[model samples]
Every structure is written in C-alpha cells, then in structure tokens.
Target chain A: MKKIALGLLQVAGLTVFSLLVNTLTSLLHIPLPGSIIGMILLFLLLESGVIRLNWVEVGASWLLAELLLFFIPSAIGVMKYSKLLEADGLQVLAVVLVGTFAVMAGSGVLTGAIYRIKERRSS
Target chain B: MITGLLFLGLTIAVYLLAKRIYASSGKMYTSPLIITPLLIIAFLLMTGSSYESYNAGGKWLSDLLQPATIAFAIPLHKNFKVLKKHAAEIAAGVLSGTVIAVISSMLLAKWLHLSGDLATSLVPRSVTTPIAMSISQSIGGVPSITAVFVILTGVLGTMMGPSVLRLFRIDNEIARGVSLGTAAHGTGTSKAFELSSLTGTISSIAMILTALFSIGLAPALIAVFLH
Candidate 1:
C-alpha cells in the first residue's frame, strides 16, 4: 500500500510540475516551447537538488519509455483524410519517403562534416 | 465497443512485433513509431473500419505527447557539458542544416508547381512536432499534413541516419545527435539515445534549436519566396 501510494504521489507530482511549468510559460508568452520550458524548469529543480533524481526517475522513465505510443493516435489522424491520401496517395508516399530520406541524408552529412572539421581544429 | 477491443489488441500485437524486431536489428526502422503506424494501417485494412473509429481511442494515447516531450529534459540535463564544449559549432551546424532543408524543399515544391498548400506543408519538414505544426499553421499549410511529414521524417532519419553518417565517416556523438535531431525531431532523438547518452543529449538540443530556427525563419522565408 505504501509503495503504491508513493508511486502515485510521484506520478502526480511530476504531472503537476509539468503542468505548472507549461502554464507559466504560456502565461509569460515565452517564445520557447512550453514543454521545453517545463523541461528546463525540471532540470533546474534537479540541478539544485530540490527534486532528487530518484524521486522522479520512476515516473519520468515510465512516461518516456512509452513516449512513442503517445504519438500513435496523432499518426492515426492521417486516416481522417483518407480520401485525400488515397487520391494523392502516391504523391504523399513519394514526398514522405523522398523528402524524409533527403532531409536525413542532407542534415546528417552537414552535421557530420562540420563536427569532423571542428575535431581537427580542436585536436 | 468491439472496435476498442480490436484496437487494443492490435496495439499490443504491434508492440510485440516492434520488440522482436528491435531485439534483432537494434535499429529505429523497427521502432515503435514505425511499427505502430504500420500496425494501425494494417488493422484499418483488415477490419474495414475508418480511421475515425481507430482514432477514437488512439487520440487519448497521443495526449501524452506534451508530457513525454517535457521528459526529454532529463536526458538534456545529463548532456549539458558536451553541448557547452561544442556549443558554437553545434549551433551553426544544426541552424544551417535546418535552414537549408526548409529552403530547398520549398524551392523544389515551387519548381515542381505544386499547390500553395503542398508547398506550405513541406515548410516545417525538419523540426519537431509542436513547432512544426505551429509553423505550418502560420505559413498557411495544413497542420495535419505537416505533422504526418514530421513523423515520417523522424522515422526515416532514425532508420537511415547511421548509414549516412558512416558514408561520411562522421562518428562524433555531438554530430550524430545534432543531425538526427535536426532532421528527424523526437524520433531521431530516440535513436540518438540508443547510440549514447551524449548523442541523445546533443540530439535533443539539436531538435530544440532546429525547431526554434525553423519557426522563426519559415514565416520570413515564405514571405520572400512564396509571396
């Protein structure tokens, strides 16, 4: 009972912290992403030793581990416009496949090349 | 009612398949992000249910994205020192890559004579979801289309990023993370985590930077190029 209660408390605490930070960012009209603001707040708390890592680790890990699952529904939103996809299905596929490959290759090459140059200079 | 059960069952099945594939390949091609979408599509085909019904339950799951995104901070905190060291180079690399990606895609779409909406949809192709969606909206693109593009970009980056890096022999963790995050967003960041903590941390930073840069630049670029 105690462990279960503690676990629940941890989850609630993290959720509240996340919500509070998100709210603060929105209210302040911060240009940064709200979730990012929440993250920074959490990081600050952790760094200051105000919130021990162990205390939040269990809850945060559970949430992060299932992170991809969280996007599943949003991905399904693709279905809402099934007719659109079916009509331009090939176009969508071509764009998604080709565009994705291009972005990955282009960014990967650029980032890798820049890092290599920096390494040579530093070393 | 029965649809809900079927959706749950399919989600479990895909989760299992993803686990099996990951165990063998240890690659993002087999990630849950890719697997789940494929599974959902398969289920839709097999059951003959429209996407609306499947989304009825699935939407609840996606609501967690906000919290999940915030959870990225933990990993970012762990990687601060590495980022601090290569801060300038990292910033320049990701910023340039992101700008190039947005510009090239928009230019290509215009050259191809694609509709304005299609061109707009392609604008936020490099950043993470929230920022991409917002950019798409401001630029008059369909947010849903941009979200789909963003996810596809992330999955592809996770799958092909390593090979591309190897082709260029770019082995630095910071570089790997920045490239992955810049191109693929959260999914790419997830792949970075598998490589190393430093890679994961840098990828998150790269993801954040790419989003900020793209969001600010996409509107201005659209005005210059499209208007």
Candidate 2:
C-alpha cells in the first residue's frame, strides 16, 4: 500500500512539473514543446544529482512503458483522414518503408566503419 | 459523457488484451500498437460512431503523453555513462541517419506529388510518436496522420531491421542498436533489448539523439526546401 501511494505521488509530481513547464513555455514563446523542455530540465536535474533517480524512476518508467497505449487515440484519429489515406496511402507507405531501410543500412554501415577506424587508430 | 467513458473503457480493454497477445507471442506483427488501433477502428466503424466521440475519451489517454514525454529523461539519464563513452560514433551514425531520414522522406513525398501537409507530416515519420506528432503540428502537418506514419515506420523498421543490418554487415552491437533506434525509435529500441541489454541501452540513447536532431532539422529542412 505504501509503495503504491509513493508511486502515485511520484506520478502526480511529474504531472505537476510538466504543467508548470508547459505554462512557462507558452509564456516564453518557446518554439519547442513543453515536454521537450521538461525532459531536458529533468535530465539536467538528474545529472546534477538534484533529482534522485528513485524519486521519479518508478513513475517515469511506468509512463514510458505505457507510452504505446497513450498513442492509441491519435492513431485512431487517422480515421478522420480516410480520404487522404485512400488516395495516397500506398505512396506514403512506400516512402516510409524505403526511407526506413535506407537509414538502417546507411547509419549501420557508417557507424560500424567509423568505430572500426577509430579502434584501428587508437591501437 | 457516459458514452465517452464507455469508449475509453473499450479502448483500454482492447489495448490490454492486445498487449497480452504481443507479450505471449513475442512477434512484431502481433504488437499491441498495431493491433489495438486496428481493432478499435473496426469497432468504431461497425458501431457507426464518429472519430470525435471516440476521441472524447481517447483524448484523456493521449493527454498523458505530455507527462510521458517528460518521463523520457529517466532512461536517458540512466544510461549517461554508456552514452558518453561512445558519443562519437553514436553522433556520427545518428547525424547521418537523421539527415537521410528527413531527406529521403521529403524527396519521395515531393516526387510523388503529395500535398504539402502530407509531405510535412512524413518528414518526421522516423521519430517517436509524441515527438513526431508535435513536430508534425509545428510544421503545419496533421498530427494524427503523422502518428500513423510514425507507427508504420516503426513497424517496418522492426520487421526489416535485422535483415537490413545483416546485408550491410553491421556486426557491432553499437552499430546495430544505432541503426535500429535511428530508424524505428521506441519500437527499434525494444527490438534491440531483445538482442542484449547493452545493445538496448545504445539504441535508446541513439533514439533520443535522433529525436533531438530531427526536432530541429525536420522543420528547418522543410522550410528550406518546401517554402
């Protein structure tokens, strides 16, 4: 029971923090989303030991784990654009498929080659 | 209002069941992300309910993505040491990957004569859903369409990542993780975790870096080429 309460508290804390950041973002007219800024701030806080891992770890992990679930509504929002999908869905799919493969192969090969060269130079 | 709550419950029920099947089968095809949306869509269509009604409840769940996005900092911080050690190669791989992802997507969209909105939406298809959707919104594209494209990119990447990596002879774990994460985002990171924890760590870091780069680069590239 205590553990569950602690987890809920942590989640509530994160939500409050994110809301604060969102307000600040709009006030400052930051182009980036509040979420991104909050992420950076949270990362910095963790790095500096201002925010202990245990404070947010459980809540953060749960939120991230359920990330896919959160996207269901937006995914369902695709139904609103059935006309668009019907007209050019195949082309979009092709672009995504081909583009994904290219990045995978290109980045993979380049990183591997660079790592090997760096290794050789060091050795 | 009650109807909205019902739809929300239905969505969660379908999603949880789909997640179970995915967990037991461990097949990319059976992923909850793929199945849940399809199932819910089918249900909505059969019921003759509009997207707005379904979204009434769905929006609450989607709202959590904001806090969830902030939660991303946890894993990123947890793996800071590994990220620092291999920062150089990871940067090179992720930079090249981001450029390739943005360019290839835009070029294809332009060549096919897709609408401006579709073209902009596709530019950020390689990133994670929340970030991709936000980027899509900022660049004047439909966030929902971008979400679908992002999911498709992720599914395709996980399905073909291994073979593509092998074809390119990307043997190192770091390279493999970087390729998958840069190409597929969270889906790729999960696939990486299946291979090894270290690879998973690398992939998550690469995924974050890809998101960061694409956040700035996607809009800039679209502005330069499209505008």
Candidate 3:
C-alpha cells in the first residue's frame, strides 16, 4: 500500500513537471511540444541533483513500458479512414518497414565507424 | 458517467487481454498495442458505437502520455553518465539515422505518388508516439494516420533492427542501441532495454535527440515539399 502511494506520488510529480513545461512552452511560443520540453526539464533536474532518480524510477518505467496505451485512441481513429486504407495501406506499411530498416542500418554503421575512428586516433 | 466508465473499462480489459495472449501465445502479430486497438475498432464497428464515445474514454487515458513522456527523463537520467562519455559520436550517428528515416519515408511516398498530406505524415513516422503525433500535427499531417505509421515503424524496427545491424557489420552496443532508438523510439528502446541497461540508456538518449532533431527538421521539409 505504501509502495502504491509512492508510485502514485511519483506519477503526480511527473504530471506537475509536465504541466509546468507545457505552460512554459506556450508562454515562450516554442514550436516544441510541452511534453518534450518537460523531458528536457526533468533531465536538467536530475543532472542538477534537484530530483533523485530513484524517487520516480518505478512509476516512470511503468508509464513508459505501457506507453502504447496512450496511443491506442489515436490508432483507433484510423477507423475513420477506411477508403484511404483500402487504397494505400500496403504502400504505407511498405514504406514504414523499409524506412525503419534503413534508419537502423544508417545509424548503426555511422556510430560504429565513428567509434572506430575515435579509438584509432586515441591509440 | 456510467457509459464513460464502461468504455474505459472495456478498453483496458481488451488491452490487458491482448497482453496476456501475446505473452502466452508467442505470436508475432498479437502485440497488445496492435491487437487491442484492432479488437476495439472491430467491436466498435460491430456495435455501431461512435468513435467519439470510445475517444471520450481514451482521450482521458491518453492524457497520461504527457506525464509518461516527461517521466522518461528518469531512465534517461539514470543512464546519463554513460551517454556523456560518447556524446558527440553518438549524437552524430543518431542525427544521421533520423535524417535517413525521414528522407527515405518522404522519398518512398513521393515514389508512390502519394499526396502532400500523405507524404508529410510519413516524415515523422519513426519518432516516439507522442512526439511523432505532435510533429505530424505541426506539419499539417493527419495525426491518427501518423500515429498508426509511427507504431508500425516502431514494431518493425524492434523486430528487424538487430538483423539489419548485423548486415551493416555494426556490433557496438552503443551503436545498436542508438540506431534502434533513433529509428524506432519507444518500441526500439524497449528492445534495447531487453539487451542491457546500458544499451537501453543509450537508446533512450537516442530517442530523445532524434525527436528533437526531427521536430526542427520536419517543418523545413514541410515548407519545401509539402506546401
């Protein structure tokens, strides 16, 4: 029960943090979403030692692990576009799959190459 | 209020059941995210229930996405020290990955003669759900379609990333994580976490940096090709 309360409190903290970030982003008229801004804010808070990592780790991990729940509504909204799907679903899925692999390959190769170069230069 | 509660309970129950089947069944297509929504979508169709009613419940649940996205900083912070050591090299790798993902999606859509809105929506398909959804919004893409695309990309990335990495002869854990995270976001990050905490940390960082870079890049591309 205490653990549940702690988890709830930790999530509450995250909500407060995200709300503040959203407000700040709106006030500053930043193009970025407030959630992304809140991510940065929390990072800075952790780095600055203002917030200990363990305090929120459990709740945060649970939320991230179940993150897809947040997107299900948006995904279900796809029901509204059956005509488009009947016409283009295969092409869209093909592009997304190909693009996903291309990205994984590109980033992996580049990071490995850079690390190798850095290692050689150092030695 | 009762209807709202009913819809909410149904959605969660379907989601939990999907997870159970996925875990016990060892089936690939039964991912909770994919299957649960499919089930709900189908159920709605059968019952002639309104999307508005379903969303009435889901919108409130999805509001947690904001907090979830922010709370991501916890894992990120836990893994920061490791990331700081190779920050520059990793950043460049992630930037290149994000560029390839965005550019390729745009080009593929163009090759297929997709519309401007269709092409634009595909641009942010590789980022995490929340950021991808929002980026799609800012770029005048359909967020629902873009969310579907993002989740699809993530699922494919998690499934295929390791094999693709091997094909490229890239074996570094940091590279693996960075690539997956940059390419796939939360789904990829989850796969990385399964590998090791260090890799997961790097993936988380890559996911954030990729979103940051994409947010800045998508609009310029939108101006050039979308409108």
Candidate 4:
C-alpha cells in the first residue's frame, strides 16, 4: 500500500511538472511542444542530480510500459476522417508504406557501415 | 456522463484483452498496439457510433500522451553509458534518416499528387504521434490525419522492421534500434523492446532525437517542397 501511494505521488509530481512546462511553452511562444521541452528539462534535472532517478522511475516506467494505451484513441480518430481516407486512402497508404521502408532500410544500412568502420579503426 | 464512461470502459476492456491475446500469441501481427485500435475502430463502425462520442472518453486517455512523452527521460538517463559510446553512430543514423524521411515523403506525396495539406501531414509521419500531431498543426496540416499516418507507419515498422534490417544486413543492435526508432517512432520502440532491452533503449533515444530533428527540419523542408 505504501509503495502504491508513493508511485501515485510520483506520477502526480510528473503531471504537475508537465503542466508547468506546457504553460511556459505557450507563454513563451516556443515552437516546440511542452512535452518535448519538459522531457529535456527532466533529463537535465536527473543528470544534474537535482532530481533522483528513484523519484520518477516507478511512475515513469508504468507510463512507458503502457504507452500504447495512450495512443489508441488518437489513432482511432482516423475513423472520423473517413471522407479523406476514402478519397485518398490508396495514395496515402502508398506514401507511408514506401516512406517507412525507405527510412528503416536507409538508417539501418548507414549505421551498420559506420559501426563497422568505427570498430575497425578501434581494433 | 454515462456514455463517456461506457466508451472509456469499453476501450480499456478491449485493450486489456488485446494485450492478453498478444502476450499469449507472441506475434507482431497480434500485437496489442495493432489489435486494440483496430478492434475499437471496428466496434465504433459497427455500432454507428460517432468519433466524437468515442473521443469524448478517448480524449482523456489520449491526453496522457504528453506526460508519457516526458517520461522518456528516465530510460534516456538510465542508458547514458551505451548512448555515449555509440553517440557518433546513433547521431549520424538519426540525422540521415530524418533527411531521407522528409525528402522521400515530400517527393512521394508530390508524385502521387496528394493535396498540400496531405503532403504536409506526411512529412512528420516518421515521428511519434504527439510530436507529429503538433508539427502537423504548426505547419497547417490536419493533425488527426497526421496521427493516422504516424500510427500506420509505426504498425508497418513493427510488422516489417526486422525484415528490413535483415535485408540490409544490419546485425548491429544499435543499427537495428536506430532503424526502427527513426522510421517507426514509438511503435517501433515497442517492437525493439520485444527483441532486447538494449535495442529498446537505443530505439527510445532514436525516437526522441528523431522527433527533435523532425520538428526543427520539417517546417523548412516542407516549405521548400510545397511552396
């Protein structure tokens, strides 16, 4: 029970921190999203030792573990745009399929080549 | 209020069940990520329920994505050592991947003669949903459409990423992670974790850096291609 309580408290802290960062982003008219900025700030806080890993680990891990749950609704939002999908679904599908494949292949091959070069130089 | 609660309950029930099925099956096609959304989509369609009603409850869940994005810092911090050693390789891979993604998306959308909004939306589809949605909105594309594209890209990546990596002879874990994360974003990261934790960690970093680069580069790249 105590562990659960601490976990919830930690998550609450994270939520508050995320909100504050978001508020600042809007106020400053930063082009980036609040979440991105918040993430960077949180990382810096952890690295600088201002925030301990244990402080956020449980809640962060839980959230990360269930990350897909958060995205489902938004993806379901595509149902609302049936008109667009029906009109250009084939074209859209083609672009995404080809684009994703290109990125995966391109990044994978390049990184492999570089990794081999770096390993050879070091050895 | 009851309707909203009902939809939320329904979504959670389906998601839990989907997770269970995926766990038992251990197949990419059976993944909770794909099954949950597809099941929910089918349910909504069969019931003739409007997206707004479903989203009335669904939005509460989706709202957490921002916080979830912030939660990524933990893994990043935990894996600092590995990240440092492979920093040069990871950075180069992510940067090149971003450039290739943007250029290919633009050229494909143009060659296919998609509208300006659609071409714009396609540009950020390589990143995570939250980042892609915002980037789409900022650049005058439909955020919702961009979200779909992002999710589809992720699903495709999760399903086919291994084959793509194998075909490219990418045996290095870092290379494999970078490919999945840079191309497929969050879903790819999920798939990466299934392969190995180290790959997952690298994928997480790749996903974050990909988002940052896409945010910085997408607007300008879109401007050049579209205008």
User: What is the TM-score (0 to 1) of chain A in model 2?
Assistant: 0.89
lDDT of 4 by residue, A16-66 (tens): 999999999999998777888998899999999999999999888877778
Best by lDDT: 4
DockQ value for model 3:
0.68
Candidate 1 chain B, poorest ten consecutive residues by summed lDDT = B55-64
Per-model TM-score (chain A alone): 0.78, 0.89, 0.84, 0.95
Q: lDDT tens string, model 3, B1-227?
A: 66667878888889888878978985657777678878888999999988888887878777888898787687777777777878987899999988887789888998988888888888999888767888999888888788878877876776676678778887788898899899988778877876777787788789989998998887886566644
Model 3: residues >4 Å from true position, as ranges?
A116-123, B25-27, B133-144, B162-171, B219-227
Between prediction 1 and prediction 3, the one with superior DockQ is: 3
Which candidate number would show the highest DockQ if scored against the true structure? 4
| Model 4 misplaced stretches (Cα beyond 4 Å) | B137-140, B223-227
For every model shown, the clashing-pair count is: 0, 0, 0, 0
Q: Model 3: number of clashes? A: 0
Between prediction 2 and prediction 4, the one with superior DockQ is: 4
lDDT computed for candidate 3 = 0.82
* TM-score sort, best first: 4, 3, 2, 1
Weakest 10 consecutive residues of candidate 4 chain A by summed lDDT: A71-80
Supply DockQ values for each candidate.
0.53, 0.67, 0.68, 0.76
lDDT of 2 by residue, A13-49 (tens): 9999999999999999987778878988999999999
Local error of candidate 1 at residue B58 (angstroms) = 1.5
| Predicted candidate 4 versus true structure: per-residue lDDT over B1-227, tens digit per residue | 67777989988898899989988988778877788888888988898888888888988788777878788898888888989999999999999999989999999999999998899888899998778889889988888788889988988888888788878888888999999999999888877877777888899889989999998998898778767
How far off is residue B23 in model 1, in Å? 1.4
**Where is the poorest 10-residue window by lDDT in model 3 chain A?**
A66-75
Worst 10 residues of 2 chain B by lDDT: B189-198
